[model samples]
Target: MCGLDHHDDSLLEAMLENNLLFDSGVDGLYGRSGIFEDVIERFELLVRRLGAPDKATRIHFPPGMGRKTLEKSGYLKSFPHLAGGVHSFEGSDRDHAKLLGMLEAGEDWSDLQTPTDVFLTPAACYPLYPTVAQQGAVPDDGRLFELSSYCFRHEPSKDPARMQMFRMREFVRIGTPEQVCDFRESWLERGKTMIEGLGLPCHLDLASDPFFGRGGKMMAISQREQALKFELLIPVNSEETPTACLSFNYHQDHFGQTWGLQFEDGRTCHSACIGFGLERVALALFRHHGPDVEKWPAATRKLLWED
Candidate 1:
């Protein structure tokens, strides 16, 4: 296999065997089938309909974000290992000749690549903070935004649920601590209900972002202690290690401070966001309801297919 040795990746094997996922000859990367895409689209539409009453401002972001924004966000300090930086070949004619020679020789020609202004976005909400800050301050009542993007993480795994590139559909709230907290709390229940309605077995649990390094251990502990994060878990790959298909988070002034986001009253705004891992959710559906949509429970199909 492409850069991967023999491993008992049961879910991945099943997906490949049944033609639900087309192999890219690489681990953690595959061509999603049309059936998979349909599920994701229907799920997202259902989410939008359910969230309509919230009147969140819809904002779509590309898969890449500014390198400066990523730097200022301190992502490198916390999760540098997961960040994907873009590099480009910015060279002259002579350099091009050398690069061609290296390619022919099968040498590592990527060292000549220069860092580009863009980096693959780590989360759907990462770009929203800076965008809001640029607009000056949040309103007294607070602000809410709906965002979606293809996020990139460096970790490659044998589990089909863990893809390096995936879609994250998020709803973000910015305001005082109370406002943000309320949003996360509501979403925790809402997310669970949505998943349960689809007939999948799931539960909500306290969770933390996978922070990095020695200091990150402390951060992770603090986050859990404060209950800053919660995840809607479902058994996609295995029951022992349930996949976090949905997450509700409270970012108590971290993004506010980094992006200089402020409220109309001048105090820094607190923020929270709920992220739906679209691909993971789809995979979970496939796992629980069978790869063929026609064979799924009627209620489940109606929930996804009906207007």
Candidate 2:
């Protein structure tokens, strides 16, 4: 299914068989088992330890965010195909009755729900911009935040690395261009080190977002040309092509301009973020260390679970 070959299909089946993952009958939506979730939590703790010195402000957001904030983020302009809006039944009892009738008749009823004022968050850092903007100008030392959220994208695939709804852990920096660029550069190496410490081989490469449509092609090209994005790749599903488990992005004045974020000097701030794909990283660990946590390397287990 979904153009998956024998090898890929087998790998997916193995995960299912081991009880690390549960198939939800949807390609990109699956339930994580207890062991799988434990791995993710341990990984997050490791990340916190690695980043403790930064003293970044920590924030957690839910799966959905204000649609107005999303509009200001320009997500629709870049990746409309991957965006998801939340809808609910905001109709009268008559409409509800009709919807129930349709459901009983085995017909469409989802249309009865009107679009809500919120949308599923596309990234962990999308809401930060507007929040910071509301707080006023940035300090001279700049702002750094540790943020995590359940991000949603509409791209369904057999490749387990590309989940439609997944958790993203991000370290966002907002400051002058020099400060933000430095943060992104430093995280490139930090990301590699973090993944390698988990017993997974990883490499950093220049990358771009999967922007949508013809115009998006140009945006991707420009992003690559400007060296605005980088990803830490690992062999989760395939050793040859690899998958991106972490990303470092430098949004030079993009979010600042969008949200009217500024520095004390009255110049727009620059922004950068380091994102970790929590599920993908956990999967990579499982792929390398096997499904049984007891079978994993002692050092790796200690690093993740003990100290």
lDDT (10s digit) by residue, model 2, range 32-143:
9999999999999999998999999998888999998898789999988999999999888899899989999999899888899999999999988888998988999899
Least lDDT summed over 10 consecutive residues: which range in candidate 1? 1-10
**What total of clashing residue pairs does each candidate reach?**
0, 0
Question: lDDT tens digits, residues 93-209, model 1?
Answer: 999999999999999999889999999999999999988988987899899999989999998988988899899999999999999898888888888888989988898899988
Candidate 1 Cα lDDT to native: 0.89
Cα deviation in Å at residue 120, candidate 2? 0.4
